[model samples]
Target: MIIELKSLDEIDPCEFAYYANDPNINTYLRNSFPAPYTLDHALSFITHSLQHHALDFAIVVDGKCVGCVGVTFQKDIFLKNAEIGYWLNSQYWGKGIMSQVIKMLCSYLFSNYTIHKICADVFAENKASCIVLEKNGFIQEGYRREHIYKDGCYHDLILYALWRNSDEY
Candidate 1:
């Protein structure tokens, strides 16, 4: 399937919200994504993402948005690095769409941004996400025990990172 990453305006927010708000889709995500997500939440997210100049995009496949991904820069000691986050509609999982979109986005970040490293955190139970990161060349840095609380339980997180080097980028 063809993949395209575009600005939030290029997508229909209602359609995106419908897929994203599904409990099945949000299960693996952070607690910030509320259950029974509303249009207001989607609008707020779109507005915030735009205003923050976040490198966010609607992951489109065959002309329909199937997911979302973004890279957020960190300042201070992490000034040279950026954190990556992504989520796909449950219906589209296992289709390799996210992998393709992530690879393209990572290439764009390395080529365009001043950042030297890209990092991500995945809940330890999210094995599929870890696989995607590994397949894209991110090294498993370490695991954070009970780092986040979600759904009434503490979850361990696995940190993964990839550095920009002439041979890799």
Candidate 2:
């Protein structure tokens, strides 16, 4: 089970769309990740990724592009902060794939960029995602009550973080 983080260019839009169309996978993701995910959405996302290769990556498992991991850098006063996010194909879940992917992404960000802290906003109900972040040395920093309004309901949001100087990494 070779897991790799590669540029989105390595995959076609269809292959990306095929794996990303899972509604379950999108539940924990941001609202920007549309449901009924289409080829056009994949193509658009790929195009956007092409311009921000430094921040986004396609998660490849045994040569198949099955998911993605990325960080969004904050601007102005928070330039050193980046918010991390990821999603994996359900078929590829529970194999510790995301744990490795998060480590790879953190290493890349800390080594290549001026990032000081990397944080993740996870839905409180998503224990699996929270575990992946904890495995990568991210500590729970805060919990916002009813912070995420998704699927016509409010969901709690848990904030987790890892600093570049943290020994846990």
Judged by lDDT, which candidate is best? 2
Q: List where candidate 2 sits over 4 angstroms from the true fold.
A: 52-54
* TM-score of every candidate: 0.95, 0.96
Model number with the top TM-score: 2
Tens-digit per-residue lDDT, 72-131, candidate 2: 999999999999889998998899999999988899889888889998999999999999
Model 2 lowest lDDT segment of ten: 48-57
Per-model RMSD to reference: 1.3, 1.2
Q: Score residue 141 of candidate 1 by CA lDDT.
A: 93
Q: What does candidate 1's lDDT look like per residue over 1-169, in tens digits?
A: 7889999977988877877777777667877876787778888888898887778899888888777998889999989999999988888899888778778988999888889999999999998899898888899999999998887999999999998983568
Candidate 1: where is the Cα deviation over 4 Å? none
